[model samples]
Target chain A: MSFHEKSNLAVLALLTLVFGVYFLWLMPQMAVADPLPPPAAVAGVLIPFVLCLVVLIGVVHLVFKLRDLKEKGEADERDRLIETRAEARAGFMLALGVFGALTLLLAGAAPFWIANALLGALVLAELVKGVLRAIAYRRS
Target chain B: MGKGKTRIANSIREQRFHAGEMTQQQLADAVGVTRQTVIAMEQGRYSPSLEVAFRVARVFGKPLEEVFSYEDEA
Candidate 1:
């Protein structure tokens, strides 16, 4: 697999772990708390998100150092093909997410919810596409 | 994805060889693309944009037709 593809995989795994921890397991548990109060502040989640970003950057960079950049030739025909397909798939995912965002807006959803939802969808689509590309490259 | 065929494959290949067995990287640097893009052109796996194609021909000091020819099979 190309270095780019490997990084993409790492990013997807990072996102999945973060999402599971914050959304599924932790958020649910928080909602069940006694006399559950609203979130401490809008910025409370910023720390975790920043930490996740740092972890992602550190992990991928450590995994694929510049020493691996010396692959004798230009990425061969196979690499090009893989890149083309990966890019196309990712583009479609973005388009789909954007389309969903449009529908929600047309339905008169709250502006804040519409914007945040669209952003989340974009992030998720990117995560899925990265994972898909990495898996495909590894298999090949 | 196969939109248009390259017409000057042979000429481009020959010029690259004549210019001291020019490596793809060297040509790519001259033509303003990544080495991978140059390799694609050399192998006939891609058809570059007209601007790039013109740049490539100019690099060889040849008319565009001198480097490329049309072939139905390709």
Candidate 2:
């Protein structure tokens, strides 16, 4: 795999782990049998903490890998083209998600729902960009 | 995945072999590309831009047509 593809895979794994831990494990555990669920402020702090931890781990791992390879990181023309196309697709996905979030807010959805929707959209956009880049690398 | 859909084919691998068995990394360094890009071009999985194509041809001291050719699929 190219460095970019490996980097994308690392990021994808990190996002999956972070979101899975936050949504499926942490959030559910926080509300179990509790009459008063924790405030959004608690969630906000914990989520950022978890995200930071995961991102740090990913950066450390990538750094080690790069050291082992002894590669001076540089993207060539093909990489640029793939990134350009992937970002274009991801940009559209992000715009649509943000618009959907706005619509939900206009329809009087809860603040929590709007926030989650917007966050989910942002994550999905990054995920889409990574997935499309990996696919383009393979298919091309 | 098949040659039918391929728009271009190249003899980079053969040319590199003739040029004292040059490594893909060497070619990539000479042509200002990543080794992975050179690998893709050699495998006919990706076509380079016109500028990159010219660079590759120049490295091999050959005409562009000698290194790459367009294919029209009917």
lDDT of 2 by residue, B1-74 (tens): 22223578899999999999999989999999888889888888888889999999999999999999997777
Residue-level lDDT of model 2, residues A32-83, one tens digit each, is 5345343465476566857685776678667857675755457888889899
For all the models shown, what interface RMSD does each have?
8.2, 3.8
lDDT of 1 by residue, B1-74 (tens): 14343444555667999988998878877876666557556667566666777788898888877766667663
C-alpha RMSD for every candidate: 6.5, 3.1
Estimated TM-score for each candidate = 0.55, 0.85
Best by DockQ: 2
Please name the candidate that would achieve the greatest lDDT relative to the true structure.
Answer: 2
Q: After superposition, which runs of candidate 1 have C-alpha atoms over 4 Å from their true positions?
A: A1-43, A54-119, A128-140, B1-11
List where candidate 2 sits over 4 angstroms from the true fold: A28-43, A50-58, A61-69, B1-5
Instruction: Look at candidate 1 and give me any clashing residue pairs.
Output: B7-B68, B7-B69, B8-B68, B11-B67
